[model samples]
Target chain A: MNQQETGAGEIKISARDVQVHYGDNHALVDVSVDISDKMVTAFIGPSGCGKSTFLRCLNRMNDTIDGCRVEGDIRLDGEDIYAPEVDPVHLRARVGMVFQKPNPFPKSIYDNVAYGPRIHGLAKNRSELDEIVEKSLRRGAIWDEVKDRLDAPGTSLSGGQQQRLCIARAIATSPEVLLMDEPCSALDPIATAQIEELIDELRRQFCVIMVTHSMQQAARVSQRTAFFHLGQLVEYGETGQIFTNPSDPRTESYITGRIG
Target chain B: MLWLTFLIIVAAAALAYVLNLRAARRLWAEGARLHSITTFHALYALFLAALPAFVFVVLWLALSGPVIGALVLSGLPDEVRAGATAAQENLLLSEIRSLARGQAFGEPEPWKAAAAARLTALEATEGWARLALVSLIAAAGLIYARTRVSASFRARQRVERIINGLMVFCSLVAIFTTIGIVASLFVESMRFFARVPFFEFLFGTNWEPQIPIREDQVAGAGAFGWLPVLLGTMVITVVALVVALPIGLFSAIYLNEFASPRLRAVAKPVLEILAGVPTVVYGFFAVLVVAPALRQAGQALGVDVSPNTALAAGGTMGIMLIPFISSFTDDALSAVPRSLRDGSLALGATRGETVAKVLFPAAIPGIVGGVLLAVSRAIGETMIVVMAAGLIARMTINPLDSVTTVTVQIVTLLIGDTAFDNPKTLAAFALGMMLFLVTLGVNIVALRVVRKYRELYD
Candidate 1:
């Protein structure tokens, strides 16, 4: 893949020739990307195109899956995340994730928001933890709908609210990068719109990396877009340029709905 | 003769099946659309022929013995029958029966010989009557069923109804069997309560059911307090739980969370094999191995231990119960969705913290239900306590002291030749009633806990 020229911005996460394998299946091959800080970078591809696999490698979420092996250097802010001293548990706190399905912990809404903060020791006491929870919920844009029932179970929320709750839970730890793997896939259109707006807002604080199947969603919320096809990064550039200008035939075919 | 009749009935039913199938096929060949397949009509006719004949044979077999005995008694001479008690009448009937079969001990009495001849004649007549009645009923049913097999006859619905009725009947048999057991226990317990006051049996500490075997026997009035026995059962159950619960739960957690697929495939069944070992074998192990080892260890530690202490029995019982708790707990833990585990881990919780704070709480209700089930099993366990725990019924909390459970007491009370009417043997029934109630209460609680908690995940 050719490195597209871009306006200068600080790189938050730099992946150099990353490859992932699941047993005999070659899932992602020699994928390289430089994700900028405080911007939304969306990875778009068809189903089974390794977009999600490459997203999981950002936070080491792939470590949970059996028979999955990740190789090559993935550095976060110039630090090797795969170093022996880097614990996946601690790495996940710094690189939070939102799943495709809105998987809220089977706990109270307040407890779900407080979980990451408590684990990362971000708050000193109960009041401080409550403050963090409120801030995260508000930033997730679900505070008004759920603030009254903070004590209610996280699973009791509607699909949109649960997805928002999961987002709040991820950001509560104050991570530098938020990895969202189709966070709006399981929500309705209105919920998806709310999440898209929240993603635009979250980009001001954290380097938001999302894997979405919707090309329109990538165009709407992302500053930089990476199109992955068949275990390779086919195109990476400014969102407007990738959608309009000619760079690769596969990218143009995918954008114009000719090939996916 | 009964077996021959049964065989004839079976043959008649088979012939009905063939005839009905052919009739249905003939109707279909004659350009009439049948509602059901040939097999349904065949089976319907077969059932119609077989069931009525079987019922007739069963009824005749049941009534023939009493009717023949009553006839023989009524025909006997007035001198032989005068003022005979029920027991005497039964004895005379048995002698007559044996003499008719030519198995009399010596030369039969004159009256007995006459009665035997009469009984033989009655039995032969009964056999011929039974055969004729069953065959007549089978033939009638076969004719009626064959005539009903028409082109549009709903034979399939009729057959399905019969099958549904059979299913309901089978279920009713299970329910009636349970009711029968409870009723028998209740009646026998009431009889025992008549001899020993209910309050005394429930509240009294002593439980000595001294049985008087002879008229001149002295000191046979036994105390029947149940407190010590109940306490002993509780103590042993508590000890078993203490030994089994933590170990079983932790092992279940490890097996569910930490074990690889290769290791789990081999380990789970090996652990379950412990449950498959019969309790009687566990009893033998407790008696021959565990008790002596515990006794020796206690002596070496400068503490006196009874040979049949609750510790030994309870420890072995606990070992026997480990698989029960572990398997149930493993099911409960594994039932927690993988998504929940992923959510916890993604939030950066360590594996131990994830299990301790999230998985454990989520599975608590199921785990409690499993533990309560294990408790019921421990309380009802018999062979292990009987073979290893002593016969002494002492109310003590000390595990090293020999104690007896309700089951062991029941076994001791009912063993050997004993009169059922006596309070000593009857006490077993009372103990059984208590054991049943306690276990039933535990099981109901466990079921409720499981049902109430199962909603959390769904």
Candidate 2:
């Protein structure tokens, strides 16, 4: 629950005094946080609390939005992402993002998974590309259901399947970190539980940072949880400690269902 | 002319109002509330008086004012009775009214003076008639409303039915108009095919329609092998598409995907200005500037060129078509969901890559629709080709050579002095029917393609 920069492990992403403003409204204040390598960190807050904004900051997805200004420095493994030498295209390849809504490209499932790898030249031959596609789909854990009809449109699948396909597409390029923005908000309870379990399995390979409104989801899936409110990081600690034992008033209220 | 319908509506509305009033009052009386006459009885009396009273006054003002003046002009004393004949009385009244306005009547000085004197009296009578009409309607409406004061009325239901009827009438107008257009086109085209041999018109290679002037001489047999004209139309239309499709679609891509918001705001209106320009001006530009330029360019390239080459006409027509392609392309591109773009970008695809691979493929149906519509426009284009491309019947594919299109041939055939009874004049209708069918075919295909795209995405 305090400003502690613990550099005990190799940090994958580091932020220093990051501030974001959308038009005249300040979205993120003078704040700083660091993400450790190969771990799942969950962001929980009320709607419009800027948890999604901070998550998008990792890969510079905020660049797509007009009037959005990022003032502070963000670095991916020690390189300044905002510097003149950095190419956004190259940077996004290193860090991939999934949206709150499961948006699959209007193409076959095979094409959807292959789109990123093809553009980045990750595979040398068609056979290599095929292998990579199958591997990505297997890792994302929807291969058995979709393996029979790879030519079917990705949108034809159920919502849970589509979300998993998007995850597979994002990881096809072998990015170092994966960003998930409310990935379960559009899914049913069964789909949500499936995704929560998948997130747990995914943490063993990639550095995962997710934004969720469900406090129980954070407790069940994340090793560490960060609480955000009104564009400020109010608390960050072990999930069990934050949920049951000690935290700021806002974090306690939000966890106990008293306030958001 | 349909004024009687309004009277029927009014009667029905009055009946509804009365029923509501009676029902409401009955409920109130059950609760021991004292009331005036039941609403139905009051409304009934009001309508009985108001309908006749208002109609009576209106008829009086409309009919009697002029009649009275005409009676006075008949040169009888004021004590004389009015005539039984409506027409004679009306004539007399008009003359008297004219005289009162300080105009002299036809050739009798004493009679003109007498007519003018009576006209003044007729004006007062007309004014009274109008007053009586207004008072009668007002009194009737007031009395009917007063009767409802003591009872509830269902005004809402009556108004709703009238509104629903109006809605139905408006909807039918749209449906009937569509039916009318198709029927007319079908019948006219049928008449044209009957006069000319359908097989000869469709398959013949030559199209020279000249007929005889006098009965003693042999008539020039109208030759209409449509192959040349159809070929010419296809050639020019192809050239136009080649010129327009690239420039228009590229500009559309640039505007939609690359341009800043401020730049787009300016460029869109400027590009749309091409649509507002009259085709006649484009025709002149094709003839005066573009034709000469194409001839020079062709000569420089070591090729023989005609002054009215298909390339010149097609190129200018394509310029005219720029707005058509760009606007539709802009719509097609914009119609692709933003979420699709987001999905692509999040996976690290570059803008150019995303647009080429994902956006353009998704918008293919809409873009094809726009191109087909542009093809129809190019085929039907007359002014530019008439001025820039020559009127020859040669079937050639070379863009530098002078060519004639179906529309240009049609214009030339129908304009010069020609006998209407001969096959020469009627040939225009045959050509028109062909042009209509081509465009109709294109529209149907375009609509089907667009519909298929809609089903895929939605």
Candidate 3:
């Protein structure tokens, strides 16, 4: 387990010296890391620590931001995503993302889940689309509650249910990697528990990278934890060692709630 | 003299401000804590000094001319006063006024010369008297205001109350102006209805409002039916909407979703400038360019086109309206949260699909409200139709046929030397009343729809 950064799980994404500059401000500095597949890799730090910025970089989400410039190399499964030949629209379908807020489209619950599959031509007919929606909802652990009223607006759900719906929306694309940006920050304890359980179940199918503010969440749900502070990746190791025996003073100070 | 009086009032107010500022500062320094700030105390003193004097001066200026006229009228010779009728007396007064101005008309009475001299003396006295009174009132008001400025004086509260009253007055000014217009329209419409049956005017299709002005002139007993006029207005409105809706909506979509920041920065203001381009200019464009082009196109296509085609006016009006509809739609699109845009884009949906599927549906209420408001505007538009559309009251929907709209009819009926007592002139008022009601109804519904669904996204 201590042999290499890739270890046994197999590298899903490998990045070297990835620099993110938002206009004059250099937001992320020389971040180099290898993330394994079929596991939850958590990025944790205080606010404005570039944790979310790194998560967005995985899917090229930073392309949408004005004045944001990305430098260096980021590869998903030996393929450079930022290549000129690659379309962001096509790449986003392969790398799905869930935002911190439960931003369900102002549409019915069924339409919300079916949106990704429909756009990507995953369904051959109406019934196939319906099947995809039901399967996605079931996998999201929200089918039992929303099965009877798929016509209801996605925004009509509780905060926790909405987050789960967002998860369903993300996975409906059937991407290889799922990026979750503080998915539990807007939810209560129960909702957070449900999402944590879902994350564990989801690790079998997709490579998951999440940005979390709570150190406990990173420790509980993640096998690998990366600590970021002031746009720098200060530490990266096994979650247990990072929390119990941090190698960096900043990471130790942050974990003990001394400094952010 | 009036401006000099104004200068004195302003000087008095300034003096009051300076004096009260010193007084309030002394009170604060003497261990008596002030209730309001020093500037507010000074402003309060200024207002007290200026307001009453201003009111008195305005009243005195208004009353002095009439009072002086009455005095001059009474001073007329007994023979002239006793024999003259009211009209004759008014004539004599004007003649005397002109004589005082040294513009002596052809032969004048000797008593008029005496009266003009008296008028000059009275006018001079009136100016000096007003100035003296305004100074005295301002000085008294300043002294009284200064005496009232104690340590516990709530000068800020008083000044704030005055400000609140001024705001209320301004709002009432707008409300009352609207009410006055509606009331006058309604009253005049009722007068028109006394001569013509209300239902007949509303429902009858024949809208010939060309009644004979003189007994010898040959003219029909003008029918006041608004149906043809109303139908023509509808035709033009439909044509305008057809031309404007797609262009405006697509432009808004492109500007919001696809255009680069640099293009948007340059384009948005240019679009707004289109809105600011005077409607009269649009009218000229319709008459000088679009009308002639349509006629030639119609000739080439072997179709009969009127010189003043409704299509010409309606299409140019539509061009004029594009910026309005586009800006409104752009605002509604922008008002949708950035989170939704990010959500849709992150789903791998292209910008077009995202705007069409997610943002357009979300912003439908606002867009519909804007369209309805624009419809009302099209109905109320005057210059384009007056410049390009026909004056004939034809009951035809064909865009190529010459047709008259309500606004065009109103302009024609009101501009000439037609007597208001007849149905022809009164018909314009009736048409105006109808136009007002229809547009008012549309605007109300539009506003209500926007307000009702505006909170759903939030």
lDDT scores in order: 0.90, 0.80, 0.91
User: What is candidate 3's DockQ?
Assistant: 0.61
Candidate 1 achieves a global lDDT of 0.90
Q: Residue B266 deviation, candidate 3, in Å?
A: 2.9
The digit string of per-residue lDDT tens for model 2 on B90-188 reads: 665566567787776466457556667766766666665455555556456545554544333443443455457669978998999977876765665
Cα misplacement distance, residue B27 of candidate 1 (Å): 6.5
Model 3 lDDT, residue A231, Cα: 94
Q: In candidate 1, which residue ranges exceed 4 Å CA deviation?
A: A1-9, A213-220, A238-260, B2-61, B100-102, B117-156
Ranking by DockQ: 3, 1, 2
lDDT of 3 at B276: 89
Per-model TM against the reference = 0.91, 0.78, 0.91
In the range A89-191, model 2's lDDT, one tens digit per residue, is 8888889888889988878899999999999999999999999999999988899989999998888899999999999999898998899999999999999
For candidate 3, report its TM-score: 0.91
Q: Give DockQ for candidates 1 onward, in order.
A: 0.54, 0.49, 0.61
Residue B236 in model 3: lDDT = 95
Per-residue lDDT, model 3, residue B126, is: 96
Tens-digit lDDT string for candidate 3 (B1-458): 98999999999999999999999998888889888988898999899899899989989988998899989999988988997888888888898999999998787788999999999999999999999999999999899989978888899999999789879989999999999999999998999999999999999999988888778889887888899999999999999999999999999989888899999999888888989888899999999999999999999999999999989999998987888789889989998888788888888988888988899989988898889988999999999899989998989999988899999999999986788788788888999999999999999999888777665544
Model 3: per-residue Cα lDDT over A134-174, one tens digit each? 98899899999999999988888999999999889988989
Clashing pairs in 2: B69-B93, B70-B92, B70-B93, B204-B225, B205-B225
Which 10 residues in a row give candidate 2 chain A its minimum summed lDDT?
A1-10
